[model samples]
Target: MPDTPLDLAHLRAFHAVVQAGGFSAAARRLHRTQSAVSHAVRKLETSAKVRLLDRRGREVRLTEAGRRLLSACDLAFATLDAAQEELGQERGRAEGRIRVGATVEFGCSVLMRHIQPFLAAHPGLEMDFHLGHDLLTPLLREEVDLAIDCHDHARADLERTPLFRESYMVACSPGYLASHAIREPEDLARCTVLSLDKAGAWWERFLARFPRTRRPAFGRVVAIDHIRALITAAASGMGVLLAPSYSLQEELARGELVPLFPSIRPHEDRFALYQKTARARLAKHRLLKAYLEALNPAELGA
Candidate 1:
């Protein structure tokens, strides 16, 4: 065999000549002169130390050595084409870590369920969820790829995608409901009410909706920082409290807590917040957007 290194041009010309069935057609397909195509085929044969063509009159055929070399060339070129195609797709498609920030209650109650299926569809992706008190600060600092929160503060650099609407529901233990004889929003004024310290805006909206009566007097008013503690207190008949419906689904199913008033639903809010810069560069943001789209209220029951 010749000591020259293999050249892709030579291999391509050889494959094209064999597949195209003649030098003239191969030259036209490759946009090269017939002589140049012939020269490339000759160089390829010399490197392999084999006779690659049998010329019978004006027609040309492949010799035994030529047939074997053509088969090897076919396999090699196919592999190279496949590798290039895959690399191109990786550069253009979405794949990478997406750090998401969410408040604790929203993260556990709603966001976590959607993540598993999203990861299943994209096994190459990784996610880091940062659950905390403040979602907007981390998002503004670009510490996370997306933020899911109830409050939508306007910022010139930030974009928002509204995921779903959720409403607050006043809940109390079955025992409390049975004992208190609370028939209307007015009756809640006489019952103890549990308050979540961090639910500032939500609490304000709740009060604004039910301004017909005075704030409830607490036999024992306890301000809790965590949602789970508030839920626990309501379940134990300690006080009536307001919380998101999604967070209270399990307890309601278990008969631990009953909705305070069937006729009146409290104030509701929509969650609409995303990073502005991230939304513009969609290749990196597609996965996060896809996950949020699946959380629409219509699909929640499914």
Candidate 2:
């Protein structure tokens, strides 16, 4: 036998193929290209010195050697899951720390509601929440395990799981709109627009809709760094805001804020949960991913 070490990637790729019965199905499940999946499986067969799959037709059939290896893979993955569940941290309690970073709007509008249930279910787990608009700073500094950021950064060391997009519609207190005779996107030029000082992606997208409305007054820019304060200023009739629908649901429902043009959706900002690719493979990291996805299901298309 060759003295090459077994790669977990190859093992996982083989397992995915066996479970999926084909490279295409496994590729979809793993978020990998079909060729990549196939290459990994082929490499596994070579390194293990065994015929792992028989792909003579549309379906792939596991050989005897492949079946044995598949069983081992199943056992290994199961054991890892169990280890995280039972003996995870201190033999009883959840045994890991995960730092999460998110914009304040997500924390207030989406994440807060899900925290109680998640924490109660995983008592041994410890988490630190950092609120900021620049999701990159904490992630680059290794301060957070993962971040809900506005882009799926395509870097060699990072992995991204799409959560949602940052789409905004113009909104303001009903009283404010009633006070101003606003008819179209051009009306924003007169209103004091509240926006996060750190980022202007949402506002930029909204403004881009109107090619000629390129003045600072269109943004009339109140520029609050904190989401809560920004929203509060808008709620108090400070000015109009370009905000995600999720962040303004309660206000809209209560009639405190009304959408200017409900039909106009801003350009989509690709939002995703980002983490170190290798660390994302860990069971605990997978759990965190699941929790965040559950909280933001609508954005995740669930």
Every candidate's CA RMSD:
21.2, 12.8
> Could you tell me every candidate's TM-score relative to the true structure?
0.64, 0.63
Instruction: Encode model 1's per-residue lDDT on 1-302: one tens digit a residue.
Output: 44887678998888777667678878887999999999998898888777788767556788998877766775575455445545645776446567888878878887786678777876666789999878876664345668877787777556677777877788899999889888876676678778876334435646666554664333445677788889998999887888887889999989999997766666777776576442434444655676676656422333
In model 1, the runs with Cα more than 4 Å from the true position are 1-88, 91-93, 198-202, 211-220, 297-302
Query: Could you tell me which 10 consecutive residues in candidate 1 have the lowest summed lDDT?
Result: 276-285
Cα-lDDT of candidate 2: 0.75
Model 2 agreement with the true structure over 1-302: per-residue lDDT tens digits: 45687799999888877766678878987899999999998898878877889997668998999877876775586566556655565565566777889877776666666677777888777888987878875675455778887755788657888876666767889889989877777677777778876355548777566565453446467778776676678889998887777777778788888888766667777778998654566656787788767665453233
Model 1 sits at a Cα RMSD from the real structure of 21.2
Q: Per-model C-alpha lDDT, please?
A: 0.73, 0.75
